[model samples]
Target: MTRPWTVRLAAGLVAATAVLTGCSEKQEANETLPTNGAAETTPELPPLGPEDFPVPAEAREMTPEGAVAFVRYYVGLTKFVAENSLDPEPLLQLSQDCRTCIRIAQSLDEDRAANRRYTEYAYEFTGYGPAMLDGETAQMGFLYVQGPITVVDQAGKVVTDRSAPTPVELQSGAVLLWKPEQATWVITGLTVG
Candidate 1:
């Protein structure tokens, strides 16, 4: 006296439905319970602007380490913009009257507008010199190596290629001003080679 396969499947389905319904009802009951006025509310974060990037706590301090951290963050942000083909507004926002910074941003923007993108542009910070702190300004020397760059258009046509065998090494300096109001540093002068 064996039951048909369809009948067994129907019975199994009914049992599963009953179990699922019971679990769902228990879940609903738990969700309806009050928290005794101790509910936690998470504060909403402010909206990010075109130029906004998260500044680490270390970079916000007005110390030598902070200056180094800020420069590292700036270089990382620039790389991020180039890699993602994003607008260079974030880089521009961190500079005051830095001509080199402005030129870099403008070049990035022009390439973006022209549908040209870098394929293999990379930077490595080799070392950082001691930071010289003035009243509200800090200056530092940095050494970095830049890998050969290759830019291509949307149609895969090479726009600019500097694919040398050896990476180019550069020694550059930066002068940054601390803005207490914003609790951050801004590049006032920059020299890149």
Candidate 2:
């Protein structure tokens, strides 16, 4: 299913600079576009197109707790997946595990394990356009991630100050961040297609 609030995927153009393609964010009913007048402007960006999204609460600051949780989830998720052969848990977790998240989790798991330092993955954030707030637990990403990933050969060296050598098909995903009662910003749910 096409997420109502979808961030357009953009494989960074080979221009002098890289541009991430994502949602533009929408405005709320009580909200009004800034007219450079006495009416103050909100700090958030509107949603992209006409798609509506439920914005969660914003964190006053980037918490260390959040960072650790996310890092652990990402790394552990990567490792646990490597050790065991599961159904689609890896892919689901990696891709926010949406109902139809497309990329094969098992395939990625084996690849990461066998390759180890050989693999690479990239996820794009829509930035603060919509200034999404954290829900009861998770923070919804108004952003959509669509980026190219490359797996490096252990035998091969990466280009200094540049990307790796062997490029692979892009693994696109939409991810959301959630928090456990004790932990903060653990990825909650997602899908690939």
Candidate 3:
């Protein structure tokens, strides 16, 4: 059977940009209206397992522990974005050349432009391995999250629903390449499924 939560597949490290067609025309700056401060305050989302995520000290870190913390934080951030009607501008900044991250940001932009939202969103990481360092580039292995994901419209109607099951093996974790000049790790790679 087809897995659920395809629309909510928030893991991957494709390329920098996605060229998807068939989407509605882009909305002009003035044409888009803004909502009141309702979305500003965090909505009452389902509580994610508190112990599952490790907070990061900074956006960029130089150590292996920092890298793992960063990945965990990134995963949590993506899940939050998926479950709430929020802006994706910040996520774009975290990516350097990660295609998956770009695609997710683009998809969020599209959803916002169309006044769409996702709900009943949940995910769980099955594996989070240590970082495999190769020179300045580090490859974090066996990291994956899977769960049910649902989308809804402004009217509170379901649009798409999918359930992601734990995979036989962890697909791939985030590929973080260290930039000495920047003094931080940039997420350059990720793979889901």
Candidate 4:
């Protein structure tokens, strides 16, 4: 005789529970439980900070190649900040009293506050010119191409639109200082046309 729908459903659930319990027991047997009879917990990870975008070993050497690598990394960090709309503190930490850097950070902060974000546009460093190094300072020129930009607010309202039929090209330069203590390059001057 066929059982009632409710009774069959109950039986199915009981069977599933038994199977699951058996699997759990097997898994427990395979695992090494704590000797103290306490539940195991995963180790917590350290908080993320500027170290997330660490200076590459190549960028650490005090050489022209190192300067180029450092500049590349800096541009990459800038792109990361702009694309993710993340805190500009990391970018600021890489610079020392740089007016353009401060302006970029302030713009990011304003965009965040206004709930505006960039879409369908990115900044790319096309090429890096020769790096000039003197003592603790280095200067380099780079070709920057920015794609057509579109910014939208929280309500999807177009806040700023720069629909350049062609990507806007700018000649940018940066002056970096080799900080011995931090073993990194810090931007002291920045300019972008």
Cα TM-score per model: 0.69, 0.31, 0.60, 0.68
Clashing residue pairs in candidate 3 are 4-162, 4-163, 5-162, 5-163, 13-190, 14-99, 14-100, 15-99
Angstrom error of the Cα, residue 31, model 4: value is 35
lDDT of 2 by residue, 1-193 (tens): 8754453332224331332223334545666565766877665533211122111223212343333334334433443343333333534533343444344455555555545343344544333223244453333223334333444435665423223333333333223454343223434444332
Error of 3 at 1 (Å): 99
> Looking at model 2, which ten-residue stretch has the lowest summed lDDT?
48-57
- Between candidates 2 and 4, which one is better according to lDDT? 4
How many pairs of residues in model 4 come into backbone collision?
0
Question: After superposing candidate 2, which stretches have Cα over 4 Å from the reference?
Answer: 1-108, 116-123, 128-139, 144-146, 153-180
Global fold similarity of model 2 (TM-score): 0.31
Model 3: per-residue Cα lDDT over 1-193, one tens digit each = 6465653463322221242332345855687578885667633323222334323445356676667766667777777766665676556655578998888778877777778776655665644555777787777755464545666777977665322332233466788877666455667877766
Q: Highest lDDT: which candidate? A: 1
lDDT of 4 by residue, 1-193 (tens): 7669989899999999999998878443556545877867965433222565666777766787788888888778776676677888877887898999899888878877777777655667854765899999999988888766667788877664423335788999989999777677888888887
RMSD of 2: 25.6
List candidate 1 segments past 4 Å from native. 1-53, 161-165
- Please estimate how well model 1 matches the true structure, expressed as its whole-model Cα lDDT: 0.78
Largest TM-score belongs to which candidate? Answer: 1
Model 4 clashing residue pairs (backbone): none
For candidate 3, the 10 contiguous residues with the lowest summed lDDT are: 10-19
Better of 2 and 4 by TM-score: 4
